[model samples]
Target chain A: MALDQSAQLSDDALLMLYANGDPGAASELTARLAPRLLPFCNRMLQDLAEAEDVVQESMLRLWKMAPDWVPGAAKPSTWLFRVASNLCTDRLRKRRGVGLEEIAEPADDRPGAEAQLIQAERLSALDAALQTLPERQRQAVVLRHIEGMSNPEIGEILEISVEAVESLTARGKRALAAALAGRKEELGL
Target chain B: MTGPNDRIDEFELDALFEEARGESPTPSDDLVARIVQDAAQMQPKPASSEGHEPTGVFRQFLAAIGGWPALGGLATAAITGVYIGVAQPGLVGVTAAELEDLDYVSTEIWPSDDLFFEEG
Candidate 1:
């Protein structure tokens, strides 16, 4: 799973491996892409389980596209992010208001119970506020903040101009900060 | 890592982003393992992507080569190159050498006559 660059094949390499029916490519691709993409989906859907499904489906598409998929037109990571984002948006549109649990944190293997509860509360507040925004704003905010992606990267992922990505993100952050105004205390940020 | 092009860069946003990324909400290991195991068991459906051509095929081909993980792709290309290059010239050269070994050139005049003329 792209561990230590041993399996750290390039997108083209992975695609070739994929073409040669190397399943390792799939795993490596997942390892590299999933963490970055998951939060965006989780924020978008406000449902961790659904976001996980979206990640799987996104990887599935990569697998399916391997045979005919070429490399170089777009960044593989970016393409996957875009596809995952679209899938999450679709899922959100299909099932509105799930009142889902906070963005499910990975079961924290460390820390005391009090710390865990506090983190959970922060996540819950953030998730709720994110869920209340308009879809476009949500996408912008998630991609920019949650995913820590740049404007140009977000632009390409969202299929919009860089300027537009910036604009959307600006509006989104303002809206989010407003939605989350009183929630910072719970967030401890 | 705020920069000239950055649109949003408040401490609050940065904190949120950090918290979002820092959380371990990644799918459970069991789930990841299941996905991996399920993947391990999967067999390629068609086995050959050669027949399936998509729109912007060339573009996708280029895209695959655009990243750091393309060693397999590069190897595949190198292998193909060797197959095309060596298989044709090296294979054909050895075959031509073998053909020369089997070639029989007949001479009407004998070397013994020329030896007699030289000695006598």
Candidate 2:
């Protein structure tokens, strides 16, 4: 089948197609999911290179698991997010004295020079503030706001109650605001 | 009254976060390529090992020489035939050679009893 045609399928359907030997399903799933998983992983790990590795590993795991995947048991995206989150947590534990220097400068795409600089500063401030949050809180906030996932889905990915997810996001956002307290004027908030 | 500096409100903080989200870095072209390559490599192979194996020559020979069930029946018949002959020989048909031996043994025993009476 054409990749565009497969694009209309759900992530679960696409994975089923891929398991059944549909060549286009793999590419369709990759294009559809890599962008989301990569950015989320980058935010969690704060290292682009490691995040990339985690994304690749996470996708590889999905491919390996496609054969046994139970349809309707869970959404493919949620499962992949869970896998990436665990991988990030493992890497974070092994990291020794993580420093701000390891944070990759995000891609700046704004048109004007001043706008681009301000955007860069805002992203930097946000990233630094995020890094200060506890790992679970940071994960909850990123998945909630940045990834645009609902509380139940975030709960599923993090294996927590929806109430816990809500609590984590609330605390995380408050902490982030405190961390970025003086940067509001520069960030144009 | 809320001070102007009372950290950013939820709405403004949300807007700032939304902007920051927009600036999230995409994976490098090389990284995407690597992940696609990994996907290609990890595609699940077709499972075809569930069927039974092809029957070999030894199995064919066994089938030809009265497979297990047939052989078992034959063994049971042989055992029953042996048991009937030994336990109740009368059920067996009498043969002429066995009758001749029985007559000779009867005459020899009676004639020897007459010789014993004359000697007494």
Candidate 3:
């Protein structure tokens, strides 16, 4: 099938097609998912290299499970995020301390010289604030706020109830606000 | 503590989330390649023409002799040969002249007289 046609299929369909031996599906899936998953893991782990490893490991797991993948059980993207999130959590638990130096620099390397640096600093500040949150709270906030996922989807990823997701996100936002309060003037928020 | 104007705080938080999202870096080509490699290695192999191919001796035999069709053809030829040999020996018969030229067999009586004698 053409790459364009493969791109039109939903994530689950793409994965199922991949399991059936269409290499195009794999390309399309990787293109569509990796960009999103990378930053999610990066933010969660605060280390770019570890985040990359987690993303790869999570995708590997997904590919391994493709043959037995149940179409209606869950969306492929959701399943991937859940896997990536879990991997990040495991790494986070194993790390001694999340030093500021360990966080990966901003990923966007476009030509806007000074503006780019400022954006990176602002992002680093936000990541620092997010790191202060409890694991579940951070995941809830990232999924709900940053990724723009619905409460139910966040719950699915976090393996919690929708209400629990709401509570975690709410508390997470308050904590983030407090952490970033000192930087409001600098961040121009 | 929940403040009186918490709605404002929520909106501000939303803006912060948007900024964070905007700053999110796309994965590097190297990382993407690694992921694709993993997928390539782990993806399941396509099943045979049949939905679920048989395994064990039958499967190995089919594989050994090319595929199922080849094995089937071989078996059919063998069975036909066996049937012809058993049910119609004349189909493969050698003529008397041909048999006479063969020194391995003797036309003259080679058995003792007692061999043909019935119990008397």
Fnat values, candidates in order: 0.21, 0.55, 0.71
Instruction: Provide the overall lDDT of each model, using Cα atoms, as 2-decimal numbers.
Output: 0.67, 0.80, 0.79
Cα lDDT for residue B9, candidate 1: 37
TM-scores for all predictions: 0.62, 0.70, 0.70
Model 3: what is its DockQ? 0.34
Q: Candidate 2, after superposition: displacement of residue B119 in Å?
A: 92
* DockQ for every prediction shown: 0.11, 0.30, 0.34
Q: What ranking of all candidate models by lDDT puts the best one first?
A: 2, 3, 1
DockQ of 1: 0.11
Candidate 3 per-residue C-alpha lDDT over B51-82 given as tens digits, one digit per residue, 9 for 90 to 100: 77567997787789999789789989999887
Model 1 spans with C-alpha error above 4 angstroms: A1-5, A97-117, A183-189, B1-9, B37-120
> Which residue pairs come into collision in candidate 2?
none
Q: Judged by DockQ cut-offs, is candidate 2 incorrect, acceptable, medium or high?
A: acceptable
Query: Tens digits of per-residue lDDT for model 1 on A1-189?
Result: 345663656876776675676656667766777777777777777677887888777876776666676677778888888899889777766564553343343332324424225766666666666766788888988777777788898899889999998888888877767765643434455
Question: Which 10 successive residues of model 1 chain B have the least lDDT summed?
Answer: B107-116
Which has the better DockQ: candidate 1, or candidate 3? 3
Docking class of 3: acceptable
| Ordering by DockQ | 3, 2, 1
**Residue B87 lDDT in model 2?**
50
